[model samples]
Target: MPFVDLETNLPASRFSEDFLKKLASTTAAALGKPVDRMVVLVKPDLPLFIFGSSAPCVVLSVAGIGVTDTAEKNRDNSATIFPFLTKELGLSEDRIVIRFSPLEPWQVGKNGTVVTFL
Candidate 1:
């Protein structure tokens, strides 16, 4: 399975299903995998702060928003994501870093209530 998770400091409306489907297709083609076998998650948050000069590096802390996790696919999805965001959302590639995490289902809770992964 080729799983892609997108975390951005933008509006969720910026990512539509059609855009995601196309992204999935592109990702599958890049990875030489089937589209049906791919999964993607889109998360939108506030903007990011990047450091360094050339090859601008992103500053990460224990407390940060927009994090994603993938499983059993290409390791460099950021390469694909950046272009997609630029073309689709009109975002700039500079000072942007799309970090990846290995995917694992977890029992989540909010407002003192456990939520279902399903």
Candidate 2:
């Protein structure tokens, strides 16, 4: 599973209901994971400041098993996501920050149990 949490100072009205689905799809495709297994949480209107200003900045965190384990893969993922974020959220490149967390299967829980995908 790939979990993407997006926290932004922008208002919720900035996003359409379908935005999450599109984002989940984009992230899953970028990571070569199943879209159904991707979870995207958008927390808008949060008090997030960048460079001492709260001018529509975003803090996006991504966690997944095997998807974010390498530097090259992370770069590739950033290459894919950066444009999407800028175009979709209308945010400048410098206004967004993304953190990737690589996780082991055992560290995740599903269906009241722990499992491995590989």
> How much does candidate 1 score in TM-score?
0.54
Among the numbered candidates, top TM-score falls to: 2
Please provide the root mean square deviation of candidate 1 (C-alpha atoms, Å).
8.0
What is the overall TM-score of model 2 with all chains considered together? 0.94
In model 2, residue pairs whose N, Cα or C atoms come closer than 3 Å (at least 3 residues apart or on different chains), thus clashing, are none
Computed on alpha carbons, the lDDT of every model, listed in order, comes to: 0.53, 0.90
Best by lDDT: 2
Per-residue CA lDDT of candidate 1, range 1-118, in tens? 5456665556667668897898778666655667786666766664544554433222211111112334333345456556755676665677556554433334334356543334
- Model 1, position 80: C-alpha lDDT score: 58
Residue-level lDDT of model 2, residues 91-110, one tens digit each, is 89999998999998899888
